[model samples]
Target: MPTALNRRSLSSLAVTAAAAALLAGGATAANAVPAAGGATAQHRACHVHALSDGRGAEVCRTWTPHGDGTYYGTWQVDRADANVIAQGRFDGKVRNLGVQGSYSRVKDFVTRACDSSGKRCSSWA
Candidate 1:
């Protein structure tokens, strides 16, 4: 009974809702855990977003056993883009990784993955 356009709109809305829920859940989980030395850690779960080339990229923040915060990222190959980039930034510090890489240092508050030329980017987490 629904038109094609209506269906597409509904689908898009569903995806957006799902993404929002995922982000909310991730934030809650991160807040509930206590970091090392009794400090609160800011960690986020992986979030996948579609790129312009139809590929996808994922960005995530993780806490080590010792409570060190790290950034993790992975992206699929897009023939149009030479390389995929993932960056995590916090407190004026930025760390970068490419095509399935994770930073070894503990420094991150937000994370995002992008395709070449920043054609497509994921929502910050």
Candidate 2:
């Protein structure tokens, strides 16, 4: 019993709703990626330096991956000829300060150190 104008409006509404539902379903199916628990891997790295007599020295460096968007590694430096351990975490590609409580935003640990300390350090990229 609707008017012709009302019928047209309802038809358009139904078409819009159908299109929206189709688009939503398509996006859900197409945008799916492997879960973090799956076979995907993530990696990150960083550098540590010890300063003595206003000079920075590299002690030790390493890079490791946990393959699930997490990483753990260690770096050592000699300040006054004593080893200083820097343990840190990498969230995918971002390095979080582990025991040192200092986060590095650089993609690689060594380049991150270069950006942080203004020194020529090796790259872990």
Candidate 3:
């Protein structure tokens, strides 16, 4: 009861529907990656410094990953001249590692250890 032209239009419609379904399925597959809980680990670091004259101080700062989604941060100034601007996230327990005016000496040279309980960057910095 349908004309040849009607059959052609119906065929075209079917093809378009199938193409759309395939595209939708493809999109779903592409989004499944992030949902698998296989997320990647992220990291961050910082530097705190304040230099003046031939006497100032600075320290490269970084946080340790605790595996359970936690972090511990520490800062260190090389010389007594490594001027200080920020104390980093050292919880004040690590002798002379922190942010403050300007460094004048290697006063409390950091031992580069982790204060398991101390933290600054949890998910990031």
TM-score, per-candidate, Cα-based: 0.42, 0.24, 0.28
Candidate 1 residue lDDT tens string, 1-125: 00011111222333444456567774222324444466443332455545666565554434332334343322221222345576555444855554444444434445566775566676555
- 26-71 per-residue lDDT for model 3 (tens digits): 4221112221155422222232232223233334433333344334
Candidate 3 backbone clash number: 14
Error of 3 at 75 (Å): 3.8
Candidate 2 structure quality by residue, lDDT tens digits, 1-125: 00001111222333444456567664221112223345322222222343333333332333233444333344433221223222222433434232333233322343122224333322232
lDDT of each: 0.43, 0.30, 0.29
Worst 10 residues of 1 by lDDT: 1-10
Q: Ranking by TM-score, best first? A: 1, 3, 2
- On TM-score, the leading prediction is 1
Alpha-carbon deviation at 18 in model 3, angstroms: 38
Best by lDDT: 1
Q: State each model's C-alpha RMSD to the native.
A: 11.7, 20.8, 22.9
Clashing pairs for model 1 are none
